[model samples]
Target: MKEKNLLKDSSAYYENNDYYEIFSKAEDGESKVVNYLSKIAKDKIVLDAGCGTGKFLQILEDVSSKYIGIDLSFNQLVKAKIKSRKENSIFVNTNLKDTMLCSDSIDLIVSPWVLGTITDLGDRELCLQDLKRVLKPGGKIILIENEEDSEFETLRGHDKDTRTKDYNNWILNNGFKVMERFNTYFKFDSKDEARKCFLEIYGVEVASRVKSELIEHKIVLFEFVK
Candidate 1:
């Protein structure tokens, strides 16, 4: 799908209470991410790329000196605006492939499940390049991507297992060092329950078959520093 159409469809697709409830259940994931970041330092500017509904931004509120969120979905940004009323928090609608943020100005960048949606490998690379350009030297990047060997097959989209691995390597090659890697598994009681939850968050018919396979699947959390 074209990027604009995909963003519009996704915004309309997730405008339901069921989707928000399922997403709220996953808020613990944000906590886990925040805990990991807390060890880094307190005095730093942070950016949450693809900050869907601003769930993770809440976790970073008390930790960072400044927090900014950027996403492509207008609907998601509206939700984020409602949740973040802090003066230091800002949300912008911009694509990661081309950002207006100043170069080498940010101290840390966090992107949970953001990279997986870019269906084009070239665009993914450009996104990474843009991220690198915007990060200061020795700055950290915490990212999470669906695990290749996991049961979540449909989430893989046109980008295959090799592509994800290549993207990981690209981060290292561009000027970042891999500091840590964590593999997390998400569980559901059964295929029906899993399907219900995913449909609510990601829209129905997007990953029905994959939901069945992802009854227990893995995601990778990567901590890197430039």
Candidate 2:
């Protein structure tokens, strides 16, 4: 019943035999962020706030004019460094809520799967403020977050995607605009992997009914023009 410190780093799970077995090939959620960032990151200085395992490192570095990946996890940053080869791409270990970057210095700031940690709109506002501080005026910030989840996400600990309605209200109140929305997946190569993931996240009874097929993951994108 022990839980991984998701906030600590992906390597924790990546190293765990059981956790890794279940999730090793569990999903392609990262592609959604990379796909979007790759399109607009050309020759732009892009910031990946929660760049887990440096998943976006290769593509962003190739497409971006300059890329900076930051995360609180030292382990994750290590992996990021290994994936990046260009002098233009660098990884920093720092908290997204606050950073040392100078004001209006970055051209593009992309934060994906980070805000879901904030359960409160007020708290989310503070996070946005920090990103806003460094973002150049009229620059773009693309935010990716999970929508309301169903019971299928049972094994998840406190990390279930925050309620969608609350997030929607927060966006509306803050005057951010939706640029795109879509349904994606946490895909598994096989049923066994899916079953293990379900069991690890939800437990035995929940895993019992989990189909081998990929599970649907709903995501929304918000584009804030500063």
Candidate 3:
């Protein structure tokens, strides 16, 4: 696969909620990403852009006064709604590039593993602009993206999302700062389950590399204060 195509392919997989939910369940089983977000998101109005399956909603809802989860996929949103527990939770089927939200409304925005899949640089910029439009002054936007040379990246057979130099440069030029680099893993109940899950989500080529139940994933966190 070409470096650029991997993200597009991965993004398409989310349209199928069944496979996507399974993939989401197997990822970051240790709550590394959630733990990191909890420290920064307390008592704020949080928007989870491209929330998909609401994997982080439970934790995000626990911290935010009001929580909004938006995605372009209604099927994904349907799955997200099932995971929502609090009265403050809202799920919207909307695109990130143009969310019809009030100006200067949100206190924090979380875009996890979502923007890089946009593929078009122009669209990514538009998405950022819209995110800025809704963000309160001094409010923060946090992004979680794949970092280079992870075992997961090797399996994907490409480096676009994982290689941070160019991606990080684009983010920096847009006024975001690197917050941290961390390690997480996709943990499965068994090697057989891992193989089956990877095969369904990543295809046979990538799935063939699943030698164990735990696959190391490295990610970088970016923060923008508007």
Give the best candidate by TM-score. 3
Give the per-residue lDDT digits (tens) of candidate 3, residues 6-79. Answer: 45744455776376677788888788888988888899999999998888898899988999999888888888
User: What lDDT would candidate 3 get against the real structure?
Assistant: 0.84
Clashes of each: 0, 4, 0
The regions of model 1 sitting more than 4 angstroms off are 1-21, 27-31, 151-177, 187-193, 200-217
Per residue, candidate 2 scores C-alpha lDDT tens digits across 28-141 of 544765687678888888888767666557777898888889876677677668878898677878767677888898888887667655555565577678888889988888
**Would you list the rank order by TM-score, best first?**
3, 2, 1
lDDT of each: 0.65, 0.68, 0.84
Candidate ordering by lDDT (highest first): 3, 2, 1
Identify the runs in model 3 with alpha carbons over 4 angstroms from their true place: 1-6, 9-12, 159-165
| Model 2 pairs whose backbones collide | 43-65, 138-226, 155-201, 155-202
TM-score of each: 0.72, 0.77, 0.91
Please, what are the lDDT tens digits per residue for candidate 1 over residues 1-226? 2212242344344443435535344433324545776766366798988887876766676678888898887777778878885796888888888878999999989887777556576877788789888999988777865455644433534234375566666655666555554444444545676666656555555445544523434555677677
Which parts of model 2 are misplaced by more than 4 Å? 1-26, 29-33, 119-124, 149-162, 198-209
Ten consecutive residues with minimal summed lDDT in candidate 3?
A: 1-10
